[model samples]
Target: MNKSQLVFVPCPGMGHLIPTIEFAKLLINHDHRFSVTVLIINSPFDATYNAYVHSLVSSPSPSFPTRLHLTLLPSTLPTNISQHHKGTFLDAFFENHKPHFREAVSNLESGPDSPPLAGFVVDMFCSPVFDVADEFGVPAFAFFPSGAAYLGFLSQFYTLMERRGVDTTAFNFKDSGMEFAFPSFLNAIPAKVFPLLVLEKGWESFSRNHARLHKKARGIIVNTFEELESHAVLSFSSNGGIPVYPVGPILSIEGPSNPAQQGFDVIKWLDDQPPSSVLFLCFGSLGYFDQVESGFLDRTAEVGIVIGWAPQAQILAHGAIGGFVSHCGWNTILESIYFGVPVATWPLTSEQQINAFHLVRELKIGVEISLDYRTGFSNGSKTEVLGAERIEKGMRDVMAAKENEIRRKVKDLSEKSRRALAEDGSSYINLGRFIDDIMNMK
Candidate 1:
């Protein structure tokens, strides 16, 4: 008869927020006795943040039963000592917000118990949650809000940094060469384009701080399916002294759309090209492309429809989309597989490089572009800047009918994804297990 409160604490970014919301919604729908709360990060993003939150709770759910709530913290900005804020004005933001956040959690710990605070599911970047959980003497779990392969890369970032040495660490973007070897598929990318988060210098302190915080958590919750990342998730569980739950394809929380899904008109936009003829492109909520990157979009337009932000679940459900030109983010990957769409990986940052690498080299479903390590190569020749032609060609190769072979290979994966979230699928089982595990934890 004990009611449990599952609080979802996400990172500051949209990519993290959306999927975590979906997970929270799923948890809420799973059982009537279980209630969910989305703990706001308390940053500038709070403005439009609540809208996304409202959309979920406002919708009707026929699956399980429960209600979703929101808990907003004042807001945590970057700090002067924070890696991303340093040299910028907001570096010390976290420093100021830490005490306020500490107070908030303490208050929650001491609050009334209609649905008592049973546990916390925190984002990987929310460092304050770890200490707050310890302060309250409550178990807190880390949510990566990304795929499993990316987790593997992050868990080993220290090793990658140590092996590369201080010289590479000190190198700036302008001077950086192909000195660092990235793990996963990103390892082959030039040292420059690996996303600012992976850069060792000037950012080392932030990375170290996050790694330490992650290790101290009770467990890690990943938004993925076991069929897709069983090995990597297992690796995390074994090493982290915490179990890593791969409960994802949570987008299915939208439930069955059935016949209307077939009539979902957008499929006509992709008809008659070829099987796997389309390359779906979406950057999630915050993935923006500047004029320099515009050519990549233009070139891909030649072979496929270029969408600014796709209703991914709807697009993936379509029969026309054969491949996805994705950021290799966890949610995208999970959704793609759920709909059986193979991927064309382009990792922007964080665990993307590793996710991209695993997709291309390990999963054999996609391909990635050169990461511009400043080796000065143009289509394998010496060049000043990255020309659009090569990117165009890469898109052509990825979207070609012959490459339909890759699509054929991914068909089973997609079906598995579909089956995973289905009634008896692995994702469904894991979700039930997750609630049971947390509720029963001592």
Candidate 2:
């Protein structure tokens, strides 16, 4: 085995951090020689969150191998960026930190306890790490913690820019919508149905980072199975020859047994609900749904419980979870399918909307909200939200007897999801391959 190690740099937020942590754990368990260290970036972690993570890393239990380690870097958002600002604060945060990040990487490379810095596995959004990897003479791979279908959408960004031009003035291309259709895994979404980052005013900061990172990365890794998105995943690879690894259905990677051992009481409550009777709703940490949105969900309390953040894997593994009202992030999608729960999607930002489209259009295991992405506010600033009636209705349709067929189909998909991480399943095989590749790297 190669003496070099695997280093993961995950951006802040549970959506990004959880998957990377799981991946690191998987690598270490498979081969002790392959050490895994997770780098936490820019976190103002409170006692509760930090303690939870520390417990996982320090647990002397059999669940985690001793080789897994975590390093917390000094993290602080730029001076002007705080939690409350919604509008342009995101852009401002990125603008302020890009330069400081370069120096941080330089310092870490030379810092004590740094391994040979074999390679970097970074969140798709943390593109700046690609530059740092380049500076340190190591290959960096952007890990899209979403589906293969969504990664295919991003792989086409450069082509879309050239064919349609940068202005997005042609956004109203109803006439040529079919010409730019997304992958079959994405369902019925037109190429037009993406987030504001694709259509925002000018070389927006997010868009710039995405493009630069795509150009810099040695490869791209998506969290999905080939059987689910083979055509699109292949097309993405064929287009740029950008070696795509569809190593996913990650919820199944650790085993059919749930990895979330901490939340036992929550699992018991979930089991009390009837089959397909509950709806799991979560929007990661970065997502902040306002009181209006919260109230809408609260109104549906008679039908299902809506906790701020339920133990996702445990709940999905429960018998009562019939459907999901998810933000369509990658981890939720994979977990829901792993447990065979159908989805009702209302994706907000990042790769979510694209994921939502595929869940409804291609997979037939979910429902998508009829949101007007083309006309919505660019900054996600909005006073109004989907009403309780819509939420309740969508939930009912998914849980109804009339939709038994939907449940059956999703059940079948879940079987496939499980198989994907089974002994020879796609995800299982890919994970083994990844371990071997990284371990053998010279």
Candidate 1 wrongly placed segments (more than 4 Å): 45-66, 76-95, 99-113, 163-168, 172-195, 237-240, 252-277, 289-308, 371-385
**Against the true structure, what is each candidate's TM-score?**
0.77, 0.79
What are the runs in model 2 whose C-alpha is more than 4 Å off? 44-62, 79-115, 169-179, 182-188, 252-266, 281-306, 371-380, 383-392, 435-441
Model-by-model lDDT, in order? 0.63, 0.64
TM-score of 2: 0.79
Write one digit per residue (lDDT tens) for candidate 2, span 1-442.
3445666777666667777777776666655666766766554433445555555555534756566667655444556445433334544544445565566556556757665657778787776666666766778888877776766666566576578564453556422564355542434456555655665544355665665555777677777888777777777766666666777765533322224544546677776777767767766544554554678677976665544544567767787777777777778777777777777776676656667767777666786554333224435564556787888887777667735877787777778766776777777777777655544554
Model 2: number of clashes?
A: 5
Superposed by TM-score, candidate 1 places the C-alpha of residue 403 at a distance from the truth, in angstroms, of: 7.6
User: CA shift at 326, candidate 1, in angstroms?
Assistant: 2.8
Q: Which ten residues in a row have the lowest lDDT in candidate 1?
A: 372-381
